[model samples]
Target: MTEVSNKTAVDPVERAIRRIQSVYGSWNRNTSVAQMRSDWDAAFAGCTVPESCRQASADGVDGEWIVPADAPRDKAILYFHGGGFRLGSIASHRDLIARIADASGCRVLAVNYRLAPEHRFPAALEDALAAYTWLREQDFKPKDIVLAGDSAGGNLVLTAMLSLRHRGEALPAAGVLMSPWTDLAATGESYLSRATADPIHQRSMILALAKGYMGDGGDPFDPLASPLYADLVGLPPLLIHAGDRETVRDDATMLAEKAKAAGVDVELKVWDGMIHVFQMFSEIPQAQTAMAAIASFLRRHLRLEAERVR
Candidate 1:
């Protein structure tokens, strides 16, 4: 993993951090889940979906097609939004997905998978697999598709890929993970080391979210639940972005080491002083750079022709 230093003005990032902290820091066990979901949606309500994208369903699975103008229809990205598997929706992430489509010059399928506490562990994974299967049935070759996700959604990306590999199905061309929560076990030292540094996520909240997804008896170390323990052999190339200040920073770094040892191509970038999934905050210059890097990595792995977007 490489640590990239950003010299951009910190004022914007600080403001973004304060905004996020204000929202996330208010949550507690007393807050109702429905209210939390609504707040999550409202937080990103200002993000406008690009005019070119269209709404579509993936074989009964709720989703939106973020297709940039003139983008090739054959290539697509399967994006999963992060909310600890209990929150987040197409509404909260449509704008970010649109940016990805605009950057990669490819269509993006952002799915609204089943959330947890209401639907348990295998539910989200099953929904993800169904969406991928729908894409395959539409004649989108596995090589032309890329899997991308952030946080808990990133966990889904890994588990979904593992499920496909185990079923003898072909894998996607590559994967892009942003601040992935790979270790449900929560054993990473960053939880302690970065405790004071991370603004939004903390150990207590992480464990609560894990329990909400896993229920009372779910195994934290289960390879399916936590890809940090899963075999990484034969998975497609991965581009992982992480923030050094985030509590899950170790999750990205440790996964990179394991994937590399397992012979999978892995590129891990640790952005100094950024927060979890910092790409969601467009005001931050690092977010723009990160999106560009993601676009370049996808084009290279998918063998798409480089065409400048005006």
Candidate 2:
């Protein structure tokens, strides 16, 4: 249960999510990437922000960029966009990533990682870890960065954290996950029970995406694919936000339990009646409110220097 008071109605978020699902019911990766992106554009229509407040660079793979407006130079956020690692592009998540930059008071580097049914496993992971390596080589300190993502991107962030830790590199100050699909095995009982309940994600669709991403090489239980299977001994502080109603809610809950058992400081916040990645959809007031909480958590955990001074 959420201990924090939430002022917005959860019903609107649910309705909006269902509306989106209706518009793109159980889409497959067989659609042309162009069509997939265009569909996302149509679905996310009507959201507008100030130009001076949001800028992007497309020179990287697929419109990936470092947003500067309302973006603080003192701190940075490395964000991964979620399309279940099969069907999303940076263009689809541009507005939402900008919101993260604004709320977290940091410069945001939105990564357009490779997708599946084409790139397959380790490709997205390689792209994500490469982004981190590139940022650090550019003089960005690990301690100055906060890693964040939604859905499959959330799994990427956690695995990237572990990858860095295993290599003896310093870890990021914090990590933020929104409705992470950390368990790809479809083991969560909610995967069955909550399929119809979850408006945005259908188990059939996700299982297909998961299979395509897994390819034929290794098990989905591999830490690179499912961070829940990894040893969580050396990661930084983590903040996970999940909707109480998502099919993957059990994923977050299990990961949190494991992290706590491993003696890691994990703050898992479950939003009552909300759905997946609602924080990125401004049409929902609850999303905006959730972003506020996420931003506060990032600042508090990542601002270690300030905390020390205090």
Candidate 3:
């Protein structure tokens, strides 16, 4: 497992972030509806993709692809952005996606899936399945593609893999999940202790989002929303990254155990100290270190050993 943690000294980026969060902002997932919307808009407002990157669409699908300039010989990354199932988009994660594309030597196709409180569990699940199927229909071989996501997106990646397996389809070559929310039940002990450490999510925030998304639709442990309940048998090799002090630390650890128990090849990495979605802060020293860990993990499973060497 790659140690996807940014455990370095504080820098300007971290210092500025600390300042903002210390006074006006908060890492708690319980921001007001208006404030959250504003933050989300600002997060993705001025994103700039590379010139070689272009917009791509598949037939009857609702997502786009971020094709890199120098196309790799053989590999593709189907990336999913994280916003607790309620917010976030491909545009919001352009910089991170670019890094993923460059590191994996694969075209990164990020999703702008439907959100929660408006669109529920199966909606995102359905979108993920549709996207995977569309990618396959476009001639992407199972072994040529990899599925990766962060937070809620991570959960969806697994759900999609399980659904594809259930439908008797081929799985991706590998999968990367960062700070995944595997357990919507919020029963993990880390959820309590790490609540203070988690910058963007807490039990209260999750419960609120669940209420908005579930809205009496079904149980939170329906195996789709919270993949920890699913039978994760015969899945592809998985690499999970978590922060030891984060709320979902145990979530990753527990999911690793469950997947291992099911005989699936799984690796779980716990970083020393970081916050939820810490991998996004590329400017931070620890974030870069964490991204390298993830890159190494993907290389190991995908046989792209020439990556870092190059």
User: How many angstroms is residue 153 displaced in model 3 relative to the true structure, after the best TM-score fit?
Assistant: 0.4
On lDDT, the stronger of 1 and 2 is: 1
Q: Go through the candidates in order and give the clash count of each.
A: 0, 0, 2
Each candidate: what lDDT? Answer: 0.90, 0.77, 0.76
- Which residue pairs in candidate 3 have backbone atoms (N, alpha carbon, C) closer than 3 angstroms, thus clashing? 6-286, 27-199
TM-score: the better of candidates 1 and 2: 1
Summing lDDT over every window of 10 consecutive residues in candidate 2, give the lowest-scoring window. Answer: 50-59
List clashing residue pairs in candidate 2.
none
Candidate 1: C-alpha lDDT:
0.90
Q: Least accurate stretch of 10 residues (summed lDDT) in model 3?
A: 43-52
On lDDT, the leading prediction is: 1
- The TM-scores of all predictions, comma-separated, are 0.94, 0.86, 0.86
Best prediction by TM-score: 1
